[model samples]
Target: MKKAAPVKESGLGMMPANSNSWNIETHEQFLLSELLPLVIGYAKGNRHPSSAAALASFITLSTVLQSEGFTRNSLIASIDASRMDIHNAPEVLQ
Candidate 1:
């Protein structure tokens, strides 16, 4: 039976350095530290809207509101109401 080709490890191919110059361990480190932020920002925001920016924005806003000691549910509701107000049609247009 023929053996299958070796599968590359996660983050291996994404490393910015030349694979031959850097050892696999160092490559993995760069992938985690340098590359991940770029990947997350680019890929998540562009490709996966819900899992990426929208979700992140909601979490960040929620955290900030909580730190200010606001009631969480009330703050969320207020934000939603404000969004609806901004998005709602002008009365003259009705």
Candidate 2:
């Protein structure tokens, strides 16, 4: 059997140095397409399908929740920025 190539790095990064920068990269495809199969094939030593499926589901759900939280925070920050703009508007423009 041919050995499959190792998966590429996910390019995960720490927070941006610039406070105003938001450069998030997502890897749902990598998780579903690559990691999921690997886990199902080799997880728990016995490679039980039920065990693998359960673990994969948990991981996928956790990742999705984290992503949702990030999106929610971004929206809140945007709203705050809009409020600042309103407060800073010239009296004539108000």
Candidate 3:
């Protein structure tokens, strides 16, 4: 996918239109560090009836959908990996 604009927070509850880079491993970091802040800025900028929660959720869900293939494959891979009986291994589980 082509990169989107980098989003940055302005001092006055405003943010730049777009920058977060991510492959698979760092996607959550990008969301929490970058996207969440951007959403917060928007909420701050327009407080009346703010839909920041919904907006963030939509963006997150959309991102997941776009990357579903990788996600599914990763899950399948884990499923096919060696299995261990961890039910009695509380110390290791903890």
Q: Which candidate leads in TM-score?
A: 1
Residue pairs clashing in model 2 are none
Better of 2 and 3 by TM-score: 3
Query: Which residue ranges in model 2 land beyond 4 Å of their true spot?
Result: 1-13, 16-28, 51-53, 56-94
At residue 81, give the lDDT of candidate 1. Answer: 55
Q: List model 2 lDDT by residue over 1-94, tens digit each.
A: 6743322333233333564233222555676788767777666567576676776666665555455454556445544655776557444223
| Model 3 score (lDDT) | 0.50
Model 1 residue runs over 4 Å out of place are 1-46, 86-94
Candidate 2 has what TM-score? 0.27
Cα lDDT, model 1, residue 15: 48
- Looking at model 2, which ten-residue stretch has the lowest summed lDDT? 4-13
Shift of residue 83 alpha carbon in model 3, Å: 24
Q: Which pairs of residues have clashing backbones in candidate 1?
A: none
Q: Between prediction 1 and prediction 3, which has the larger lDDT?
A: 1
lDDT tens digits by residue: candidate 3, 1-94: 7754333332322423333332233487777788777777777777833476656666665555444444655444443442544344334231
Alpha-carbon shift of residue 25 in model 3 (angstroms): 4.4
For candidate 3, give the lDDT of residue 93: 31
Tens digit of lDDT per residue, candidate 1, span 1-94? 6743332443433447564553435577787787666657765667865456556656765765575466867766666655665447344221
Best-fitting candidate, measured by lDDT? Answer: 1
